[model samples]
Target: MLTLPNILTLSRIVTVPLLAALLWWPGWATGYLLGFVVYSLMGVTDYFDGYLARAQGAVSRLGIFLDPIADKIMVAAVILILCAAGNDRFPPLIAEVHVIAAMIILLREITVSGLREFLAGLQVSMPVSQLAKWKTTLQIVALGTLILAGGFREQVWMHDLGLATLWASAILTLVTGWDYLRVGLKHMD
Candidate 1:
């Protein structure tokens, strides 16, 4: 259904490409700033979509299905774009070692998605956990901060803070990922 919540989620899925394009050029500081603004707006929409759905009792099956997909698509696009944007630069948006962190996050996302799909077939719902929520928050902040850092290239601290949170979020990602995998395996043959 095209409820307001569903509409908000749809907006996020559609905006991801624009977010990617904005981050395509790392040196375009102004573009990065604008990208940060866009990213923040997307995040706001993400929160409201779910909240409005719950508050209004308008949580349709379509909304549930599309919500996480939108989130994964957004995160994946941002990570891939940021990693790609910095490959040739001395200090890329996502540094060389930090790419490992990004990879970990990406791998977990794919693996969990598959696990969730398998569980869905069994009529089992794997709701997001508290720890996973924390991980998601950190991941968002890490990625957003990195984008913000791009706009203020001279503020090396922003980049450093971003990297620090990236690593922290990656660690949390592994923990929560394992938790999901453990739950998933229990349903396996």
Candidate 2:
């Protein structure tokens, strides 16, 4: 149960609070830079955990279960922290329409989670689609770029780019979320 891959996944879950703390101050460029580093490291761990698990043939039920949970937790924490920190300061980090994108991502996460559970209860496995994988990639780039933007506050371009990807991810989120719901509904009464 305690394989290295699983440990790596667990480490990401363990590191969420520290990431949140580092991003707590929107005005603190130093903190944001460090937060970007921590966030990057977490992303590294996320990749290696699965790579090592497959390479070593150590994949377990625990690993399968915890991986997505760790990802969601990390994403949610970043979104919430960014929103809160932005509000705490003057102009919001997630700002106006970007907040809607964030909300879409969050809502889709929760809805998909519930739908996944429902499908699992019916023993109907709903595999992630390729488009969903693209959405996940967009989400990673979007959030990471946004965090990096916090580090480089003067770089309006970074923020703009981040928001662009964010909106893109949200659109994909809607499509993928609907796909999951459609599949889940097939199993329902």
Instruction: Name the top lDDT candidate.
Output: 1
- Model 1: lDDT equals 0.93
TM-score between candidate 1 and the true structure: 0.97
lDDT tens digits by residue: candidate 1, 57-152: 999999999999999999999989888886355257886788999999999999999999999999999999999999999999999999999999
Models, CA RMSD each: 1.1, 1.2
Pairs clashing in candidate 1?
none
Each prediction's Cα lDDT score? 0.93, 0.92
